[model samples]
Target: MSRHNIPDALWQRLEPLVCLPRKDPRGRPAKDARLMFNGVLWILRTGAPWRDLPAEFGPW
Candidate 1:
């Protein structure tokens, strides 16, 4: 309903795929992997800048 045009279904599938594997080689915690994946998808889908993503979804 906002300027964010990424589809809901596409995002749903991507959410889990993006959230997993958050562990780093050194066991360091990763930031919101979900947001990162979503950002990348958004860029590819809508060609929008990563910095332009909504604050509520968090940053890439």
Candidate 2:
């Protein structure tokens, strides 16, 4: 995992709270919640603009 990635232990706890079903019949499939959450954390930690988010975290 990258330095910015959330730990597996912590992510296990947070996952249920933060994530919706991956396959939603009512709409398009959801993006990976953990990926998006880490992206948000990276931006908050670095104080960067949304456009500056790294590509590893997926589209900003």
Candidate 3:
């Protein structure tokens, strides 16, 4: 896990709260919720603009 990523303990709690999309006859699939959540956390944790997010988060 990356240092900036969510910890498993916290993720266990958070994972239950997110609703993911199914791939059945849908539009573009949603990105991985874990990564997206981590990306959001990264920005909030760093207090940085979304454009300034690290590349490790992928195309912020």
TM-score for each of the candidates? 0.41, 0.82, 0.71
Candidate 1 accuracy as lDDT = 0.62
**TM-score of model number 2:** 0.82
Ranking, TM-score, top scorer first: 2, 3, 1
**Which residue pairs in candidate 2 have backbone atoms (N, alpha carbon, C) closer than 3 angstroms, thus clashing?**
none
Better of 2 and 3 by lDDT: 2
For candidate 2, what is the total of clashing residue pairs?
0
Candidate 2 structure quality by residue, lDDT tens digits, 1-60:
999999999999999888755564787554788999999999999999999999999988
Model 1, span 1-60: residue lDDT tens: 344445678778766765666445676565755455555666777777777766766754
The alpha-carbon deviation from the true structure for residue 28 of candidate 2, after best TM-score superposition, in angstroms, is: 4.1
What's the true lDDT of residue 50 in model 1?
73
What are the lDDT figures for the candidates, one per model?
Answer: 0.62, 0.90, 0.82
Worst 10 residues of 3 by lDDT: 19-28
Pick the winner on TM-score between candidates 1 and 3. 3
